[model samples]
Target: MPGYKTHMAGAAAVTGVAVAGIYWLGFYRPNFESMVCLGIFSILGGLFPDVDTDSKGRRFFYGAALLVDIFLIYKQQYRYAAILGFCALLPAIGSHRGWTHSWWAAILIPASVLVAPMVLLGLPWQPFVPYYLATVLGYFSHLILDGKF
Candidate 1:
């Protein structure tokens, strides 16, 4: 398992590669909106996994990030974020070492992310698929660099 320094360095490298890959594949190309969207997702995605940390400030940061996620993506969950977060802390506290480092999240998280807007935004299948795919690619890089050891 990679440590925080290793994870961060690897994630940065992967982020660069992902952006380049999207540009080269013409998924991004000269599209300014796509690039900007990817950038936003990249920032959020990169920090998300590590938010569930043991450090005092990191824990607070994690809680804040969860609130942000709920506020931005699922406001219905916003009210529950802090309360649920408090609950989430127990098991995490019990099993801090091997818990967050799970590979299962890679498959599950992206799948939900891709489907989330179909339910939330009521977007048609056409634009939703490619847009979600792009977002997944950007987000998955962070998961991979998380090093599920």
Candidate 2:
């Protein structure tokens, strides 16, 4: 299986191709900041499937989650913090290559990027479509690299 660096590179390559295709088709044009955010999301998604195991991905995600959850709590955003806490525990609910590695998860898990802001901040879901797609693509790259797709 590919290591973290390989997975990250694969995700970046896939994301670049996808963005180029989208741009060529005149579908959307992302600015520099949006592109950077997309890359970040894709990289995170690429690493996420390994979060159930004792790997660098798990530590990075959990460490970041801990900091974010703490910030949310400090800001009195108890509901968001609770949600984050629950999500951070999800990977540990199954084995290393369990639900998190499934194709359905590749789609469904990323949908949170689209749904959460809509539900919590009353933001429109349409604006988050690219982010959702970027994450899914990254996740698919991981699956491909692992020969699971």
Candidate 3:
């Protein structure tokens, strides 16, 4: 299986290509803010799949998740904050290469993390579509690099 660096680089390449395609094809409005958001999500998604393992990935992922949950709480999004916190911690229940490396986890885990904030924060779904797609693509890149696909 590919290591974390390999997976991350693959995901970034995939996301960059996809984003460029969308931009050149005029699928998105091509704003700096949206592009930055997409980039950040894509990078995080690349690293997300390894969060279940007892490695540095876990520390970064969980730490980020914790910060996000705290921000949610500050924003008064109590329920979604709790849910995100739970999902962040959920993978630790399984051993490395267990559920976290599975196909289902690859899809659904990112979906939950991406959608929950939208639902709880009353953000429009349309703007976040690219972000979601980029993240999922990055996540799938990780899985494929890890030979899970």
Candidate 4:
């Protein structure tokens, strides 16, 4: 199986091609900030599958979750913070290369990018479509690298 660097590289390459294709096809014209956010989301998705194990990806995501939870708590958004904390523990529910590596997870997990904002902030889901695509493609790249796709 590919390691962290390998998975990240594969995801970056795939995301770049997909973004360029979308831009070339005039589907979307993303700004610099949007592009950067897409890249970050793609990379996180690439690393997401490994969160079920004792890997760097797990630590990175859990640490990020912790920071976000802390911020939510500071803002007195206890409900959101509690939800985040509970979700953060989900990766541990299954074994490595189990549900987290499934094709369904590749789609379902990243759906949070769209659903969370809409549910929590009452934002429209349309604007988040690019992020969802980027994350799903990145996750698929991981599965491909692992020979799971």
Candidate 5:
């Protein structure tokens, strides 16, 4: 299995190619903020599985999750932020290589974006579709690289 750094690098590389493809295909306008957010989500997805382990990866993941949760709280989305915090802390109950590294995690984590934005903003799913795709791609790449499948 590749290390966290390797997985992140691979995800970043894949995300770059994907962003280029999106631009090349003319599916959407080339927007810097959207592309950058996509890339960040992809990288985070790559490292997500390791949050179950007591490693640098887990620390980083929890840190980022907590930061986001804090932002959510500031936005007055208390219930959503609580859910986020709870999910982020879930892996700690297990030693490692458990649910966090499973196939379902890959799907559910990215899929959460589908519901979260709608809950927060009452927006349609169109805007989050690209981010969802990027996250799934990066997450699957990590699992494959780790020989989980």
Candidate 6:
């Protein structure tokens, strides 16, 4: 348990520092509100495993991908993209990192995006690759803090 807590703390600090550094060093102006949000999310992601809260990160993280969802829905007839987003992020709201942390998710979660547009869309690597990477990165980060590492 102590190990878990220790790792969680490390995760928080690391995520925070990394985000903060990126925001500052990327040579872009750090918006005040965005800075605050980044800090909060970094902390939340770190502490995420302890509460076992459903996919809080997943639900919230998708905001960044909203445009992608909309794009897929409109351009590719992949309504499943949005549905996949919903399923992927929805269960996250209550599932906690433990359930979402499974290695199976790294594969299935992203692919699940195709479920809604099953007939309209063919599986493509373009979107799925980045989505899977992000999911795996965040999920694994949670698992590590939870001592599932």
Query: Which one is best on lDDT?
Result: 4
Give every collision pair in model 2.
none
C-alpha lDDT of residue 80 in model 2: 93
Clashes of each: 0, 0, 0, 0, 0, 9
TM-scores, all models, native as reference: 0.54, 0.93, 0.82, 0.94, 0.82, 0.38
lDDT of 2 by residue, 19-81 (tens): 989988999899989999999989988988999898888899899989989989999999999
Ranking by TM-score: 4, 2, 3, 5, 1, 6
Best-matching candidate per TM-score? 4
lDDT of 3 by residue, 6-77 (tens): 776888889889988978998766678877777778777877778777666678887877898889899998
lDDT of each: 0.52, 0.92, 0.77, 0.93, 0.83, 0.49
> Per-residue alpha-carbon lDDT of model 6 for 39-60, expressed as tens digits?
4444444433443343444344
Candidate 4 structure quality by residue, lDDT tens digits, 40-142:
8898899999999988999999998999898999999999999999999898899999999999999999999999999879999999999999999899999
Q: Please report how far candidate 4 places residue 147 from its true position, in Å.
A: 0.4
For model 3, the superposed segments whose C-alpha errors exceed 4 Å read 71-78
* Candidate 2 stretches greater than 4 Å from native: none
What tens digits encode model 1's per-residue C-alpha lDDT throughout 11-62?
4556557668877897656366765665545444444455456544255556
- Using TM-score as the yardstick, the better of models 3 and 4 is 4
Q: Compared with the true structure, what per-residue lDDT tens digits does model 5 show for residues 24-106? A: 99876658988888888898888888878766678887787889898998999899898888887688887677777788989
Candidate 3 Cα lDDT to native:
0.77
